[model samples]
Target: MAVGLWLVGRRAATTNQPQLATWRLTLALPCLALPCLALPCLALPCLALPCLGSWLLALGSWFLMSDLDA
Candidate 1:
């Protein structure tokens, strides 16, 4: 989980286009969702925690970058 979050944070750091990043995250949902439907109990945490954490990290990175630009 830490490794995955670290990768997400690094990606968020390098990503210059916020809109593109938003779109990519949006697009990833269905891809994550379909697998979760197969095994709800096992997949929920697998789908939810990392996804939510990574997204929050992405948003935080975006906000921080915007703050720096201001």
Candidate 2:
């Protein structure tokens, strides 16, 4: 579902320019990837304590990203 959204949004944003979309996606990758990584860390037992760290980092990163856009 996320991949589909990414593809649709990229296609719409770049029209027929695949390379442009790819480059733009590369820049956006970390923002998307970090939360995916953190979510699992936040749900597990072995890394339970680190879960708070992961959640906080994800929240901070998202806040900063949106703040920067404003």
- Each candidate structure's TM-score, on Cα atoms with residue i matched to residue i, is 0.36, 0.36
- How accurate locally, in lDDT, is each candidate? 0.56, 0.60
Clashing pairs in 2: none
Cα RMSD for candidate 1?
16.6
Off by over 4 Å in 1: 1-45
Error of 2 at 2 (Å): 34
* lDDT (Cα, tens digit) per residue for candidate 1, span 1-70: 3354346556866876556545445544544554533334234533655565666799899999999999
